[model samples]
Structures are given as C-alpha cells and as structure tokens.
Target: MTEVRGRMWVRGEPADGFTFSAISDCLTSEDTLVWADIYDPDHDTLTALAEELKLNMWAVEDATAPNERTKATVYRTHTFFTVYAIQMLTAVGDSTSTLVKHRISAFVLPRGLITVRLPPVAGDDPGFGMDEVSQRFDELGGQQYGVGALVHGLLDVVVDGHFDAVQDLDDGIESLEDELFDEDGPKRGLQRRTFRYRKDLVELRRVVLPMREVVSAIKSRRLDAKTSPELNPLYDDLYDHVLRASEWTESLRDMVTTVFETNLSLQDARLNTVMKKLTGWAAIIAVPTAITGFYGQNVEYPGLNTVAGFVVSSALIVLLVAVLYVMFRKRDWL
Candidate 1:
C-alpha cells in the first residue's frame, strides 16, 4: 500500500493545491519548502518518485530494505538516512517488556524533506505517525525555518519516543530487582525475567546507539539553508537527547547484567545454607545410632537384659539427642 501526503509552504505560509508533480515548481522560490511523507511505498511507487526527485537508487533500496541499521549518507544532491522509532510492548501478566522497532528513513534536500515509513519487521508496532510529525512541524514554525524545522520536528518526535522506551525498560528492571529479594518472589520466574530484560536492552541499545552518528551527520552537512541559526540549538538539544539515551541504555545493560549475576549468587548461598542444615540433622541422627549400637553388642559393657539397664540406655540416648538438637538450633543449622 502506498500513501503519499504533503504540504508546501511559500514565504512562511502554506500554499494550496500541493502535489508531488508540483514540487519542482514550488522549489523555484528560495522561500518555498516542501514536506512529503510516503507510507509503505512499493517499488514501482518509489522508482517513479525517485525519477522525479532524483533520489539515489541505493538510498531508495536502503529505505525499503529489511533491518537497515540506523545511519546517514550524504549524496551530491541530498542526504539519505535511516532511523528507528522504538515501541516497548509488555504483555499482560508479563514481568518483562519487549522492544519493537519501526523503521523511518528520510531524504533531506535543500528545500524539501521526504520521509518513508516502513512496516514493522514483527509485532503490532504502530510505526511513526507522520500526522504528529506534521503537527509538530507547524508547532515549531516550519514555515519560517523551512526544512530545518521539519527535520527537527521529525527527529524530536523520534528521540522522544526513544526516551519513553528507555524509561519503560528502566521500570521493568526496577520491578525485577524488587522480585529478586522477595522471599516469596518467583524463583524460576526471576531468572526468566532477567534473561528477557537483558535481551530487550540489547535490542534497544542497537536501535539507540547509532542515532548519535545519524544526528551528527545531519548537522555537519548543513545542506544549503535547510537549518537556520535559530534551529542550531534545537538540533544540538536533540543531539543531547540522543547522547543521553545512548548512555542510559549502556547503564541499563550493565544493571541487568548485575541483576542476573546477583540472582545466581543468591541461589548459591541458599544452596549452601540448605546443605549445612542437612548435615546438622545427619550428625544428630548419628549420635543415637552409635549409642544404641554400643548397647546392642552381644558383650556390651553395660545396659544389657535388665530393667535398670534398659532405663539407663534409654536415658543416655535421650540426653545425647537433646544436647545435639539444642546446639544445632542455636547455630541455625536445624
């Protein structure tokens, strides 16, 4: 399914009757800017659009290719790049959350910006919504700064989504930490949850870490007048978000690792305590066995075949067992 929608702004105000065919005419004026959003475009649609926009064929392929890494490539005519918007999915009754990636590729030109929204590789990911991006562009005064405002609005939404996903993962990790120490907490479940969280964090880091490079590539190219001086701080601020998200992801990876290792250590400690208690009980049992065995011998030194002897042997057994029980109890071995 191919869906195309866009608007043209002339002299910082929206121009009516905007269409793909009119892009060339709209760009004739230095003050005119275009923002086109294409969703799930097929090869035929892209090929035709590419012919019209003079987009690099390789860049078009990268846009539609499955699992393209987050990156930016500058061509002689324009800059092409890919980025992922993240969605964190947590199932009902699931202690851990899963990360879903939505691929958003774009071509940054001097007077126009074309964004491609691809379907998610898996899961029900609501890919990036360009309506919100459009609204954001307007909110940021895209009419005044031209393409720079549009680019900032687009990336601002993306980076904000990344922040939200990171926060979700952080919450999941904290919940897992709470479960780790609870005496009645899920024993086997804790291990499974930690593994799941670690896996999610890895996926998140893959999607997040590369954003720094992508954003930097945009700033360095400067692409004619795409970004004005007013938008520099905005992009810099967006870049900071990318950096913070990257660092937060790194920290989370380490945190989940520690949680996994700590779970193992706690299990080992519990096992040792169990073994010690068993050993104490075994030692207490051996005392009675040894005392009776001595009395049972055919030529026993004492306590043989007499009422008085029977009482004496029984007394010895009771006294020794009682003493051992008290000692073990005091040491928390019972």
Candidate 2:
C-alpha cells in the first residue's frame, strides 16, 4: 500500500491536519514549510505527486529507478537525491552478520521537502521512520530554518544509522581477530565470516562514499542563499559525520583485509611446525631400524647369535634413540 504522511510548520510552529493534497496550497505561503513522506510509492502515486509539485520528470524517474546509485542532482526547480539507510545484523552462533540497505530519495524544493522510500517495508523501524524524522524536525525547530532544516534532520538520521552499521561491523571484525590465533585451527566459519564482512563493507562503502557529494550539493545548491544562517552549522556538522562514516568504512575494509592475510599466515606457521615434529620423530625411529638391520647381517663379525650381541645391539639402539629424543625435545621439534 502507498502511504503518504504530511506535516507543515507555519512561522516556526507546527500545524495539524496536513495531508498530501494540501501541499500545493501550503507552498504558496512564504512562512510555511511542508514535508511529506511517501512509503513504497507506486508509479501512479509518484506521478500524481510529481504533477502536483511540478517536479522534473527526470528526477521522478530517477527516484523510481531500481538500484539507483546514491547521488544528488540539481535541476532548475528542485534538487533531487537518494540515500540509503543501513543496518547491520551482527553474527549469531554459526551465522555471519548481514548488512541491510534501504533506499530513501528526496526532492528539495524552494519551500518544502518531499521524501520517498522504496521498500521491503520495515514496520516502525526507526531507521525509516517518518515520525522519527518529524520528531527530529520538531526538536531542531526545523520550520524556522526552512527546507534545509528538514533536509538536515533526515540526513542526520541516515548518517547516524551508517555510524551504527560501521560500529557493528567493527565489533564483528574484533571477534574474528580473536579467532584467528586459535592453537587448534581457525574456526571453519572464519573464512566465510571474513568474506561476508568484506562484501558488506564494499556495499556500505558504495553507499557511504557518495554521501559526501550528496551533502555538499545540498549545501551549495539548496541551502547557501535560501536557508537560515543557523542551519549552515548544522549542515557542516552533518557533513563532518558523513566524512567520518566514510573514513571509518575505509578503515574497516583495511582491517578485514588484515584478518584474511593473518589467517593464511597462521595456517602456514602451524603447518611448518607439524612438519618439523614429524621429521624429528622419523629421525628418532630410524636409529633402531639401522641398528637392528646391522644385526640381521648373515655373516658373523663377533659374538653373532650370542646373548651378548643382542644385549649390546639393544643397548645401543635405546641409547641412540634416547639421545635423539632429548635433542629434538630441547629444540622443540617433537
């Protein structure tokens, strides 16, 4: 189902009963700011809203396009952009962690902002909650600062979600680090989990890296002359957050790479240790084989077939084997 919720503020105070139909009329007032959120909008629903807002058709098409890259575009009438909200489900028991991304697109007009979410809907998920964005708007006095405030509130929520996803991935990486040095062997899932995290990080980096440009475009094209002075600092702060998240993701990619390489190195070291111990034991066993084989010779040397010869050979075998064992043990090869 297509669900659209609208909110308006008049001269810094929120007004009730705002709906999608009233958006055009409300935009006529200079003192008013409108925000409408449409959830899982169908093409028909989006087209209707686009006609009402007189939005650029190309921007509308971009919004509905499948797997659109995160970006911002400035048309003459409005600024359009898309961003993804991220969530990381940490590994549980034998399962590897998962990274989930939800798409949210926006049209920033001179007097208002409209957001469209594409889903696999997450019911009451704060990450995609219009109410949470609304509450953020209210808390920040968004109406007074113009559409920029609305944009900021929405992006703030998104960036925070990115931070959360990055943190969870970091925690997962730490757990994997602890498992890498196991004396027995790495866990069977170690490789699988590392690959999963690397894949997830790549996906996250794709979503996060573009956010820098997205925020910059909104600041330069939409906010500079139009929005209140107070909101600029907020955008600057928000931009910092975007940069930090982007940097954190890059660092995580490096960390996962390290974990993978370390796992291979540890395996090689264990293999070499096993080979050395085996070689040492084989050397010790060969002493008795050589001595007994000497005794098995048919021709008599001295005391052949005598008890004295048997005792002498057995003593020499035991003595040589014991010496080899002690030497190998001292060298930690056995």
Candidate lDDT (C-alpha), each? 0.84, 0.86
Summarize candidate 2's per-residue lDDT along 45-91 as a digit string, tens digits.
78987998899988899888888999999988889999998876545
lDDT of 1 by residue, 84-134 (tens): 888776654345456777889999888888999886655455565677778
Instruction: Identify the candidate with maximal lDDT.
Output: 2
Query: How far is 2's C-alpha from truth in model 1 (Å)?
Result: 1.0
Superposed on all Cα atoms, the candidates' RMSDs to the truth, in angstroms, are 2.3, 2.5
